[model samples]
Target: MTIRFGLLAFPGVQQLDLTAPYEVFASMDDAEVHLVWKDTSPIVSATKLALQPTTTFAECPPLDVICVPGGVGVNTLLEDADVLSFVRKQAAQARFVTSVCTGSLVLGAAGLLKGKKATTHWNALDFLENFGAVATPGRVVRDGNLFTAGGVTAGIDFGLTIVAALRGREEAEAIQLSLEYAPEPPFHSGLPEKASVEVLGRTRQRLAGSRMARQAIIARLAAARHGAE
Candidate 1:
């Protein structure tokens, strides 16, 4: 079977969050990888890196897996009706719906994480409850068909886990070995709980505006959706 895996891309999307899993999917056996964006042209990342998408969100075929990536742009993308609607629709038909970093916030905005257990970049885990998800602290949390991973590099682990679920542990292990999966972080401050006071404060400040903006948009969207019904 040629598994169709769609990776959602938007302006200011995270680099590693999208690319790490893209590598994994590309290495998978007989899997078709697609980078989907709102526009048919190139999309820029938060780090100012530009990427050309293979398909538009509306044009993507029914996918075996859908991966939503997160970065600064998510502050606006979470509230984008077009993106959220597309995600909700595609996710309904996908065998697996996965997210990396704050991408879970987008999934939550799409109303796909309600009453599910999920995890995201540690700093944002508390916000997951707003979507009715049980916030998890682990690197990867698998609740049924919804898979969420922690910040940045966790996408690789998340992909391996999904591969194990889809194919088998042996297949996942083989892929892991092929990629030489090993971690050696220079800093111990990756997680909020483990970070120094200054590091945590700085990180929070950097994301504070974005988080506030997303929260406002979420409130507005919720009200609008509720009023329409």
Candidate 2:
């Protein structure tokens, strides 16, 4: 049987976070990958790159996997009723629900991570607690059907891990070899604790404004959902 995969797209999505995983899944034998968006036309990335969606949320099939990727756009999606609703519904039916970076926040917004251990972009782990998730520090954490990965670049690792789970380690290793998945960062600032205090402060400052906005929206959504309950 052909495995069906869905990759969600929204405005402000990190280009690499979504594409890297796509390349992995697309390379798999007998897998059909669909870019599912809220729209039918095109979605623009945070970097202003344009991507066309093959399917809209309303038309997405019962998926074997649903991959949500993080980016600057997540701040806007925090309170988007339609997007959250689609995520909740599709994830409920999906065999595997996966997220990268702040994409976990969107899954949390969909009520998928409650009482579950999950991880997100290092800078955003505290926010996951706001949704009742136990913030983990691993590059990838798989809890039942929900698999989450940390930060932007971690998507590559997360995808490779899942590929091994689905197709076996040998197949995944062959693909990894073909892709030359080795990484050698010039600096040791990838993780939050590894970075210098000054560098962390500077990076936090750059994202502070957007983070605050997203936090506020997340709080409001949580409150609204609580009130309904």
Candidate 3:
């Protein structure tokens, strides 16, 4: 039997978040991976890689897994009715609903993470509470069938974990071995708390504009929700 996977593809997505997991899944037996977008056009990644959608939202199959990857583009998707509707519809039937990095924000926006323990990039963890999700700090978090990866590189770990659940530990191990998925970075700056004050400041400064934009969007959404109730 074939296990189908569909990941949301949009403009300005973090390429590694989508591709790293994709490579893991594609290594498995009888895996069907489809990049689903509004259309079949090539979308530019945040890092400028051009990726073509394999299927349209209208043409996506009954996927066993639905993955959403995060990037600067995620802020725009927070309130996109069509995108949220698509995710909610897919989640209704998908065996595993997952996201990478800030993509959890999209899942929360789709009303899928209510009261669930979830995690995103460290910088955005606090925002999870806005959606009634318990903000967790971990490399990868799984609440039932909902799996969310933390930050960027965690996507590889997230993918292997899901594959192990679906296939087997041996299969995941074999795939990991094939891909040489070992990690031991020379730097200890992966987490904000561990980073030097100078590193943190520079990184935050680089991400200032996007962070500000996301905060504004979150605040606006919160106010709108409050007014509606």
TM-scores, all models, native as reference: 0.93, 0.96, 0.98
User: What would the C-alpha RMSD of candidate 1 be, to one decimal place?
Assistant: 1.6
Clashes of each: 0, 0, 0
Tens digit per residue, CA lDDT, model 2, 106-208: 9988888999999998778889988889898899999999999998888888888888888899978887888898999999998778999999999999889
lDDT of 3 by residue, 60-178 (tens): 98899999999999999998999999999999999999999999999999999999999999889999999889999999999999999999899999999999999999999999999
RMSD to the hidden true structure, all candidates: 1.6, 1.2, 0.8
Worst 10 residues of 2 by lDDT: 217-226
- Mark the regions of model 2 whose C-alpha exceeds 4 Å error after superposition: none
lDDT of each: 0.89, 0.89, 0.94
Q: Output the TM-score of candidate 2.
A: 0.96
Which is better, 1 or 3, measured by TM-score? 3
Q: Model 1: runs farther than 4 Å from truth?
A: 225-229
* Residues 1-229, model 1: lDDT tens digits: 8889999888999999999999888888988999998777888899999999999876789999999998888888777889999999999999999999999999999999999999998768888988878998888998999999999899999889888888889988889999999888888987777899999899999988877877787688778778999
